[model samples]
Target: MRCVVMFSIRMDMRVILFLTLFTGLCIADSKGNLALNGMAVQSSLGHPQGDAQHAVDGNRDSDYKKESCTITKTEFNPWWRVDLGNVYSVSNVTITNRGDCCKDRLRGAQIRIGNKLDNNGNNNELAATILTAPNGTQTFSFESVNGRYVNIFLPGNDEILTLCEVEVFAVIDTPSYICGPRNLALGATAVQSSILSGAGAQRAVDGNRNSLFSLGSCSHTNADRDPWWRVDLGEKYKVTRVSITNIGDGSAARINGAQIRIGNSLENNGNNNELAVTVVSIPLGETKTFQFQPIKGRYVNIVIPGRNEYLHMCEVEVFSD
Candidate 1:
């Protein structure tokens, strides 16, 4: 009788252990970071000083998507580039429109960043226009706070995105995000290559130089008012960085907001819905780049909640810690 009792007690312990492990895996697969500690995250709209300098890009990768490099659709026309330097701070940025011949000069333009993006709401968070140059290359920086991701939109008058060179500088001692909500301790940032759509959408690049990013959508011309998209990283992963490029559909297209979330999906109205998660949005597209304070999980959901038309989503990327 005593021997039987001992055997039964051991079996009970093993069952408990198995159950705990199984539960942990389920949470990791489902709620992701929320399955752990994702209950205390807020939006960072009015974050302090988040504007930085315009930088230049060097051809680092054979694929041109490796390290900070220039990407020009045409040759020497408007050769555009970006520099991924450690986060410092800045105020304004100046760009040199190195037009080839015929004063292929630049005209009006706008800057983009993480904050200016909609935080899943109609919150108008905009970085100030420090300076504009229709004449020549100039410098710009904003000191309202600290920001790293930067982009200068030189709306082509005719058909000229002729970017010659892009130069960037820094200010703050620490990387931005100190005031922003994404208090991420990042490793390296990479752009998810072709996998930007379909399944494996949320999958990020390996710590290696893997060019693959699948988040949010580029620009949807179909104009599905309630248009939406999602990402699945195969297995759960630790997300700690982001970089986005978006050119809102039109001037009146107010729905260029990004509703970002983390969690597992359960069935939705007709499809699956991201359940038990933490979500936030940034209206303006990622000016240059955006990093979050390391959140452990796998799935990330980007919802638009059906707003404006022509509200295209450009390159949506995520990074592992």
Candidate 2:
């Protein structure tokens, strides 16, 4: 009887130890509605009484008869959009239509997500379409798209674009590369292949996301083939993510197609290192976060390969574990 009790106690201890280790390894995917409130919104017109800020105020009281949004009387492809402050891997978008009337006004509304501001961001990539749901909330889900701007456009003449609430659900990631708790890219040495004007490479590592890599705040390459920027972390570490902030107000296109690479290699401008993520595009003044399974490296590089296009960087941050 004594031996059996001792064995039972030992087994319980083993089980507890196993459970604790498993819990430590599991990291929950932080989930929440990213577009809850306090996002910048804009609209084409302010007549019929509607302000763009009403769209993201988390109010679902969509009574068109009441004083809600500044509505315009039906025009050509009238659009409304919200700037989410940063680029996000969007999962879905929920729109609240006017419960009182004009729910059909949202028919054929194209939901676009991208960085392009041409045509009031209507020219960007289409993620989903707004279905007609009268006096109710409708959620449109896409296959995990990425963007900083979310626009709703009714592509027709004399169409009213009325929105009560536009809730965007995105995978919000902690900024591991910025000046915050999980920041690992702080105070690193940055260098670029060329410098344009007074913009040097160190501005990227200066921990300021406001500096534009375009005119006078970031590093730029002049007449250089495959302009590249790199950061040295001084010591070898296992990198987990890399985030880049693009210039605001329609300058994000400058960093499109840039490749992020990480490794200990210095040959060929560190282009031969482990490939991180190819930046398809980033929205204006938004940070695009790229994740990896923790690659070990001391050098990180962002290069616009095979193109003579100038390299621009407002900020570049690297995260390591």
Candidate 3:
């Protein structure tokens, strides 16, 4: 009987150890190349077959004739950029140089990352500079930098840029409050400035984060100056955070410069409440969470001031800590 009990205990320990190792391996394998989901563009096209999208099509074919590489026309400061849709803590970038010919074209190229659109993101933070062209593929590792744009700029007169593939890896930060209290905005009374077609204000708080507008799950407002959306939490409570999801189909930049306010007052349509934050940008089909010092309020408002543009929101979530 003693021997049987010891054997059972040992089996259980072995099973627990195996599960721990398996779970770690699965998490490590889940991080994939982010460049595959990005939108690629270049300064100018050189070869008829060298579309900018070719470099990120998940192919590393070195032969340019096979149409798996990108080429820019001979010009000063040629650049290629990929919009990653959402901001990420980029850890490393890998570049595959053309092996068939003219590998030297990639020399002196600079890799930059940031959210700024100035100069087509070429003026962002420099990650690395390619002094020597790689014979095949080269990986450049750096301290994690946060950005939504990744650009490759070649600085020289009469120089053409060619790349077979570009891969970006990000350091995914685990959420701390994944399981928390119930959302305060769910089933709450929501009102917007104006309705566009069948889209109403209540859809933003329906507990659905579907980003597609065609799915009838989003709220839309007509093009009006300073369009606003507000949700009443029944009574005032300390608000801890707000999460807003933007439309996925298009015009995701319409939410830029929007303001979040909280208070019980309906003055100026709750637009005069305590300011929570100013949204700079939220990538398409993505949710951005803003956490600030707890503010007490029953009405939470999101207004895009100083603008005459449509307002669309796929989801809006409010939480109290």
Candidate 4:
């Protein structure tokens, strides 16, 4: 009986050890410093050794002389930014201050994150503000903030921005379904209300997402009230989503407020079909996807109603479940 009890105790200890190690491994894998894989830029270079890339070079050397820091030229609203390539649910950002000298220069800097490039991303959502100089390395932890760009801006006249290291940690947010393959709109027939300068409706279904209007791959309609475009898939399909690419060069807001309708009815030029989604905005030269419950339709219409404006579309793609 004593020997059996000892064996049971040993087995329980081994199980506990295994669980602890497995949990540690999962936590480590889920979080990593994303700044290393991102692209870094600053308002201006102050020193040759103080390139923006140095701050994210996986180095924490706080001494500017060591060349592991970034220094921007003394100017108004000095700033630095990093592009994470894709949007993420960022959890925390770690910043290492210049330990060698002039740590006070970092005071009053703001950390911002978002997808907008307006004012060089300075208009993004604010995450934190440095109230005092960090002694060395300080971390600002916050709730999951979704964005693709992280910016550090110092708002003042003749203020300089310096950073030794910047680290970002995040988790991947997976979507319900991945889009690719089996597109029904590629081989469909497309038509528009009116053509402008030979910009026909078929260009929107050419399977090319080239956003440049001068490239002749986009569809254009003359300025008119309630201009519309439609696509026929030859057969009824349960469309799960529609992806629209907006003009890249300029005037992307023209596509805003457009309604996406899907149904078999051609009444009102299919503009009265079941509404799928309304386009709010698509960034310049970017694609915006609208996903919803499956809607059965043979005709897909994009109509901008109650206004007189040109309808421009770089590409339109339809997907089914």
Clashes of 3: 0
The best candidate in terms of lDDT: 3
Backbone clashes under 3 angstroms, per model:
58, 7, 0, 0
* Candidate 2 collision pairs: 47-71, 49-69, 49-70, 50-69, 50-70, 50-71, 51-70
lDDT of 2 by residue, 1-321 (tens): 000101011343532111112101111112234454433445455564587767776667777556554365567878877755446677688888877776788888888987566666788898988665545888888877776678887888877778887777764233321111234455568888988787778877654565444434456667578889899888777788888888764356768889999999999878789998899998887878999797898899998888778777777877663
lDDT of 1 at 45: 12
Model 1, range 171-253, lDDT digits (tens) per residue? 32334412222222122222221231242222222111112112222433334454444445555656655554443333323
Cand. 1 Cα-lDDT: 0.33
TM-score of 3: 0.49
User: What does candidate 4's lDDT look like per residue over 1-321, in tens digits?
Assistant: 000101011343532211122101111112356667356778899989999888888888898999999999999999999866446677688999999999999999999988776677899999999999888999988777777689999999999899999988664333411111345786479999999999999999875566888867789999989999999989888888999999988698999999999999999999999999999989988988999998999999999999998999988988775
- How well does candidate 4 score on lDDT at residue 57? 86
What C-alpha lDDT, on a 0 to 100 scale, does residue 253 get in candidate 3?
94
- The TM-score values for the models, in the order shown, are 0.33, 0.45, 0.49, 0.49
Which of the two, 1 or 3, has more lDDT? 3
lDDT of 3 by residue, 1-321 (tens): 000101011343532211122101011112346677356878899988988889888888899989999999999899998866446677789999999999999999999998776666888999999998999999999877787679999998999999999988766433320112446787689999999988999999875566888877799999999999999999878897999999989799999999999999999999999999999999998999999999999999999999898889998988777
Q: Which should have the higher TM-score, number 2 or number 3?
A: 3
Error of 1 at 50 (Å): 28
